[model samples]
Target: MTDILDAAVERAGLPVHWSWRIEVRPRRRTLGLDVLPDGSIVIAVPRQTTPEDVTGVLRERRLWLAKAVRRREALAAEHPAKELVNGEGFTYLGRHYRLLLVDEQTAPVRLRGGWLRLRGDAGAADIVDWYRVRGRHWLIEKVRSWAGRVGVEPPEVLVRDLSTRWGLRTKDRSLAFHWASMQLSPDLLDLVVVHELIHLLVPRHDDEFRQRLLVALPEAVVLESKLHDEGRRVWMGAVRAAL
Candidate 1:
């Protein structure tokens, strides 16, 4: 039987108090609510489970489920839609950059006078590519500056778009920064930098590695939370506009 059918039988018109979206897949398993990495809540039930059973479980875990959903909704609200246009501003490395439209340039994006000027013929793709290049240069500079203070220099830095991750570091001391990360706040971007640089010294995220990261960035946890809440929407919007 379908999970919905079962839930209906068990619930039998249970009073509506807590509400949640339920999903039943044809998996050979029982029911569970999974906390997705993107912060969405998923109540996964077997195809045979009825709505009543599902509702019962939901009622049992109402507080847990509600808290998770509320968090996601709040984060979604924080990443409200943005109107990308001339005079609109963005930040980089703790500085503000106003957007300007230019009609003559072949390249789609350029930075000047604390402004990120885009060619009038450009679209989101051009902007993304442009920002990626700029992000690499900016990140590299930041990394070099911070690394010098700690007496550690990475061998190389790579920049590209990556979904589901912000950055990566290899044993060879090469670093990869997500191009999509350009849309993130400077604080989070710097956290990524510190993360990869720390990897050069400690390859694993053990307690010692975490301690080292904290020494470099005391607000890493806060920045990471903000990134988790707003990063995807920011990048997704830009990518969609560019397309």
Candidate 2:
């Protein structure tokens, strides 16, 4: 199957700048193309899909696939990593706070005197936990406010590592946010909050959804662009041994 798809993509004459793979999804009814966060392409198709069909679909979506891959590549290049050391900077709600290693602390991490205080023994995981705890509390209130503006009840909000996504509205009608998003500015954070809240009303990103989102966030276009640019700089748990 892999050889056949590779040959098909070659015959399709698509640009070779991006990496791609084929996935046979047993339950998938139609061909789907996805550009992963790291700029890899995934071509998902039903089990019996032929190389010819895959080639045709790829050709039809060639322009879109190129654009998506370029965007992912740009983001991958801009993504930032962190070092777990004193004087290292961490962002919370768009504010940069220097990490201060302390000999003793009540918790593994805490914000005190405008510094992100970390216990000398704590590792990167502890810092992530700190963000989760802080983000959950902040998002709960944020979700409530956005929900009210969208004329819907606030759903249960959770904060954790959401991988490539910044936010998700689950089937249970609850909202889950990536803890890294706590690094976003308050305005960008509000955009994310209101985006999920609006999803509670509109399930898909269609025209109606865009109209409603614009009503809720007048500066959605500008803020979304900024979010994409700034979000790449947020620390996503990568840490160096020392700087």
Among these predicted structures, which one has the highest TM-score?
2
lDDT of 1 by residue, 52-84 (tens): 677777668767766776676565554443346
Candidate 1 lDDT at 141 equals 84
Model 1 RMSD in angstroms: 7.2
How does candidate 1 fare on TM-score? 0.57
The candidate 1 region of ten consecutive residues with least summed lDDT is: 234-243
The deviation in Å at residue 222 for candidate 2 is 0.7
The estimated TM-scores of all candidates read: 0.57, 0.70
| Minimal lDDT window, size 10, model 2 | 74-83
List model 2 lDDT by residue over 8-114, tens digit each: 88887888777888888999999899998778999898888889998899889999988999998876666655788889999999999999999998899999999
